[model samples]
Target: MGDSHTSHTGVRFELLGPLRALRDGVEIPLGPPKQRAVLAVLLLQEGRPMSYDGLVEAVWGGSPPVHVRNLVQKYVSGLRRALGDGPLLEWTGSGYRLSGAAVDDLRERRQLVDAALAARDAGELRRAAELVARAEELWRGEFAEGLAAPCLAAERLRWSEKRLSVLEARLAGQIEAGRPFESVHELVRLAAAHPLRERPVELLMLALCRAGRGTEALLAYEELRRRLAEALGTDPGPALRSLHARILRQDPALLAEPVPVG
Candidate 1:
């Protein structure tokens, strides 16, 4: 592993959106989509060497053009020129590896999320919320947007799910800290965006109820129930239903601080 300052001086790869490279705070132009895809594979693998065959499969899936190895070499050479001096892209046996410390936005976001969870577990609610919000800010949009490579699908999905999980965890923490009103607008937008996801709707309902808008909370539940039934021929889950019942009975427990969702 390289020193933190050395890593900071090297090339930093961004794959959270379109593939981009930056060194000393200036953007480095990665050639075309295919070239970017190749770099993306290597970066996603960290410093692990990817064999020639593996690179081909990742870049082109099942059908690769003739003389694909030469084409891949071309891309690698282009990347080397674009990367300049700091980090080294080295050929290992029949494979290639990107060496030197590189910062990945996705990895950084995950680290922030992990830190937020640790803080929350340690009863540092305010610090946890701030960290999770910072993590959420790292996403510009979908991961590898405009890159149509099959090799990136799994990682993209994993990052997307983790982002949502972090967002929900943040909301839950806010609600538990008697800050439900603070997350109302965000919870509403999230519920509207993902009508079928019960968790956001549940959070929205809880937030509304906590804010003394119990009627609106019931309305949100009704809308979610109708949407779920119409779209998936199913009703809201038991937890939500029980919550609805609690709200209807004006359970004083609703006003009490609740446990954070894991």
Candidate 2:
């Protein structure tokens, strides 16, 4: 392989939303949707060869061609040309597979966010924030943007939920560190975007209380209670209810309490 091709062979592939390739600090194009789908399946099976039938099932469901193997090979050839050779893609007796060196963003994000949570649990708030920030930055809108497939759609929701969880944790950490004022604007934005999520509602209440706006905090909780009943036929969770009681009691402890890291 040419030096450039050899160096680029182990390009990281991201297929959680849209297909993206990162090699040498730049994103190499993975072509149109079908071509991207082909790469998605290959990346999904990274480090392990997949049979022709497996690729066909992943890409075409039950409508694959009799010449599925040959067609798959053609797609692989295009990817190899675009990706440059080294161990990017290979055909084997088992079928076809992308090399393990291909970076999987979903796996990486999970690890980074989990590590950050662990650090937070240990009271290493600064390092936890950095790790969570880095992980959240990995997301580029919906996974596989412009790519259409039932499989990708289903997978997108799973990744989106994980990303949201990470965001919630990171934002909670910021609030705990006395940065709720910085995140107040963000919490407002989140409330606007996700009116149903109770965590943001609680966080906003706490932020208001911390800023000495106890009256406003009580009003916010009342609004959330109304919204939850109207939209979800439910009440606030235990934490939010307890916080509301604290607000009502004018508990000095509420003001002195450390924001619990989530």
Candidate 3:
């Protein structure tokens, strides 16, 4: 759950940003693009043996070359060499399995997020914020940025959504702990980045109102309303509209620390 690197003696695989491998502190040079893609497929299904047909489908999609099985074998050979003598990869007669204990940043991030949610449920606001903050730090960039395999698209989207959810939770926790001013800047940026996602915009408005900047909060809502009308042809949802109305009347409830939700 907590952030951790792979152990010194075990194989460490990184698939969150790019495909990387290390063993005992020495970097293993994964071969060319297709080879690395093969490694990704294997690592994504670590202990399970992926069939040759599955590997072919993952690496080449619908346009496999003639003698594609031979090509896949060659890639596997290169990966084995890159893996050195770690016995991490094994052939299971029908397919290959990547064995041994492996550390993955994506898995670790998921764990941290789970821990953060548990902390929040227990009313440990500060601990939840810290845990989600740690989880957010694991994302270096887009998932497997340079990997050109079609098979990674679904996983990439899934992980990206999880990351955004963690960000939203972290920001909400910060605002709920009587530190709306501390999160105002971040909420502003998040709202700008995702204009259609009303949660961040709502949070930004609440933080601004709580910070005694009611005018700016109103302006933020107006800008978002304009954008939404232009882009989606819809008014702000009920939650956001309610928040806007509350801010307009300087509702006393806004002065107290309230968890902003949309």
Clashes of each: 0, 5, 0
Work out candidate 3's RMSD over C-alphas.
Answer: 2.5
Model 3 has an lDDT value of: 0.80
Per-residue accuracy of model 1 over 176-236 as CA lDDT, tens digit each: 8888889899999988887799999888889999899999999999999999999999999
Q: Which candidate is the best by TM-score?
A: 1
TM-score of 3: 0.89
Once model 3 is optimally superposed onto the true structure by TM-score, how far is the C-alpha of residue 88 displaced, in angstroms? 2.8
- Candidate 1 vs candidate 2, lDDT winner: 1
- How big is the positional error of residue 72 in model 1, measured in Å on the Cα after superposition? 1.4
lDDT of 3 at 205: 86
- If both were scored by TM-score, which would come out higher, candidate 2 or candidate 3? 3
After TM-score superposition, what is the CA distance of residue 233 in candidate 2 from its true location, in Å?
2.4
TM-score for all predictions? 0.92, 0.82, 0.89
Per-residue lDDT tens digits of candidate 3, residues 50-111? 88888788878888989898888898888888787764677789888877635478678778
lDDT, candidate 3, at 193: 84
Model 1, runs deviating above 4 Å: 1-9
